[model samples]
Target: MRLTYSARKRLGATSAGVVLTVIALVMLAPMAWMAFVSTKPDADIFSRTPLSAPEELTGGHYANLFDQFHFGTSITNSLVIAGATVVISLLLGGPAAYGFARYPWRGSGVALAFLIVARMVTPAALVVPMYTIMQNLGLLNSVTGVIVGVSVLNLPFVIWILKPFFEQVPKEVEEAAELDGLTPGWVFFRIVLPLALPGIMTAVLYSFLAGWTDLIFPMTFITDANVMPLTSSLLQMQTGYRIYWGELMAGGIVLTLPPVVLCFALQKYLLRGLRTGY
Candidate 1:
């Protein structure tokens, strides 16, 4: 059958839309199941048709999470740690990135390479040394320790991401600002930063997520229930004999919500940052 050009284009677009819709549903299926299991009673969760609509909805799992598991404390801890990680990563990494972008010095390439290598080093390998250092410094079981560890882990990536954005800023602008008697720091704070705001926000979002979702650092460094973050608290739900699937599912939803919400909220800035930085 011969079709008009516009008709063929419309058919192609419709096919593409259908494929994308199916892919989206596939990706979201697990998250939907998690939410479903969270709201279902234990019997429904264990039913032969697990994905079927619940016969009775309940908030018992969520209630148990707060009342029995003390997930409220963990959520608070994750918030504090992630917030601190973002601030510290920006404070330290932002300038480091700017320096790498603007000022080339002796061994600058080597230094940048080393930073990339540091980022590649597995977190698992560093866990023992980090635990030892934190223990020696009396920072174990402290939010400060977790914040510092997470910030260090995220710093290299933050610097790497921001450097490209900084490089995109025209040097002539900085030179013009300098000729007007503005110092380098002033130029960076007033001029360069505004231009690079999108990239900086991207770094902040990623660094925050790193700290928020980390299980290894919190599990290794913290023994106190008072300081456990959401990731570590979720682990406590599992034991040798059995697992609390319902409460765990509810906790997983709670743990997942903030980052999901943040990504949606900052989708514009994040997309812009990626486009600009690359």
Candidate 2:
């Protein structure tokens, strides 16, 4: 029997819902376990079933993070690195994306292709050269060095993301603004940028995350606990003789929250940006 249009639509919706529900569960299961373990007393973590409810819960692991691991300092360092990376990525990538979309100069395509290729190079591959560069610049063992490393890796992605959005901005609108005596800079900042804000937010989120979650650069360039970001700082939980499992889980939870909060806050812009440029 031929299904009615409404029936088919309902069936499709149901299928999609089921698929999304399963996918969400799949993604959330490990995080849910992590949260549970973070709160579970160490005695209960291994003695019971992995997902079983614990008889006791405690926040001691969280306290231990600050007391033993200096997690507060790590959080601050991560924030600084992530924040600076976002600013630098937007400042440089925004203009470059605009120029790429609006201005057709000689070898521009080649330049952009080269940038895309650079972005494709694995981080592992760049580590040796990046370390040498940072060492020569006297940026080693510092937050600034990690920020520079992250920004270099993230800039090309930012440019790639924003270029299509910039291209979608109506040239007619900019010309109209120019006719009203707005300077080119004003037209871009006042007109083009406002229109392309979704893309900007998308770039901001990714660039921030790139720095926040980066481990290799921080591990390679930074030796001071004071300068280490939360991602690498989590490693302090592991010693040769034993791993602080409870505190490790607590630290994981801490490292996970900022990105989750940021994603929730920027969900609207992220969705719009993903839809707009493509």
Candidate 3:
């Protein structure tokens, strides 16, 4: 019995939906388990029926995180460092991207290629050199060092992403702005930036994520508990003998919430920027 075209189309769409739903659930399973474990008592966390609903939800892990681990201070440090990194990346990368897209100076192509290569370099390979340099400069074990490190790592990516967006802007609009006696900087601020807002937001979001979730730089550069970010602070949950699963899970949830919330809030612009390449 052959189906009609409409019926076959509907069937195909339904199959696609099911497949996508399954994939989404697979990806989200670890996060869901982390959240569930965070709410369970230490005794109940290892039950045979691990996925079963807890008889009672407890905030003990969260309490221990704040009281014992000094997580509040870590949260503040992470926020400050990530915010600083985003500002630095945008300030430096935006103008560089505009120059790459709009200007045709000699060696411009080579410079852009160098930026791409810099982005490709592994963080681990640079960690030792960076540590040495920061130590020589007396910047190690401080929030400023972490901020500078993360910002440099994110800047190349920001430029690469934003350059395409700037290229999408029509040259005629900028020429008209110039005819109206607008300086290049003013034209960029007033016209080109507004036109590329979505891409800017996208770049900002990625830069924030890079800075927020970076563990290597923070772990290597920051030894002072007073200024550790959440990523490195999570390491404190482990000891020579055992790991604090409950507190670790709770901390993981706390760390995950910000980026998730931000992404959802900016879902519209992020999706648009990705689809349109701007």
Candidate 4:
């Protein structure tokens, strides 16, 4: 049987949809299990049915997570570090990305290369140096130390992600703003920034996730239980409570939520920013 062009197109789309559905299911299974197991009893959690949906759901684990584990504090600390990283990263990296995108310099290529080089360097390589530096400055086991250290890890990623978006902005609009007697700084703040807000926010979201999920720097730099971020705090969770599986899943679910919300909220902007800059 011969297929019409319309029939073939429909077939192609159906095949693609099926492929996407499979991929999505593969990605979603673990999260589904995590959410499911969160409602399970401690005994059910360790059984072969780790991914089984609970017959009788309970909020006990979530309550234990908040009350016994003091998850709120670690969450607060995580937010502070991620929040600070987002602001400082945007403040510093945005201008640099814009500069690299807009301003043509003989050395601009070299500088961009250097920034990329920073990304290629392993965080593990710097652990010793960072630890030594923190010790000398007396920042060991400090929140400020974690922020600064994570920023170093995040800045290069921000620069690479944001530079393309910045470059996508039209130079003519900037020139038109200049024609209207708008200073470069004024144009950047009023026009360019507003246009780039989507890319910028998405950049922040990505950078924040990088910092939020990072365990190495936090583990290496912070020793005190009180100052630890949530990722680092996860280590202590299993130690005291005799491994409360439900509570662990609850925290994992909570941990998964923020960046997802952030990405969705800024999605329009991120898409526009990518199109504009790309």
Best by TM-score: 3
* Model 4 poorest 10 in a row by lDDT: 269-278
Decide which is better by TM-score, 2 or 3.
3
Global lDDT of each candidate: 0.90, 0.89, 0.91, 0.81
Candidate 3 per-residue C-alpha lDDT over 1-278 given as tens digits, one digit per residue, 9 for 90 to 100: 99999999999999999999999999999899889999899889978988788899999999999999999999999999889989999999999999999986999999998988888789898888989999999999898888888888788888988998899999999999999999999999999999998889998888888889999999999988888999999999998998999999999999999998988998986676466532
Q: Can you write out model 1's per-residue Cα lDDT over 87-180, one digit (the tens) per residue?
A: 9999999999999999989999999999988888888898889998988999998998888878888899898889988998999999999999
Worst 10 residues of 1 by lDDT: 269-278
Judged by lDDT relative to the true structure, which candidate is superior, 1 or 4? 1
lDDT (Cα, 0-100) at 229 in candidate 3: 95
Tell me which of candidates 3 and 4 scores higher on TM-score: 3
Candidate 3: where are CA atoms >4 Å away? 272-278
TM-score for each of the candidates: 0.94, 0.92, 0.95, 0.88
Q: What is the C-alpha RMSD of each candidate to the true structure, in Å?
A: 1.7, 2.2, 1.7, 2.7
Model 4 agreement with the true structure over 1-278: per-residue lDDT tens digits: 99999999999999999999999999988878778888787777778865556577888888887787778888888998888988888888888888888886998999888887887778889888989999999999888888887887778778888887777789899999999999877888899988877678778777787778888888998878778787887776777547766787888888887867776887775565455432
Clashing pairs in 1: none
- lDDT (C-alpha) at residue 201 in model 1: 86
The TM-score between candidate 2 and the true structure equals 0.92
lDDT of 4 at 200: 82
- Evaluate residue 215 in candidate 1 and report its C-alpha lDDT on the 0 to 100 scale: 85
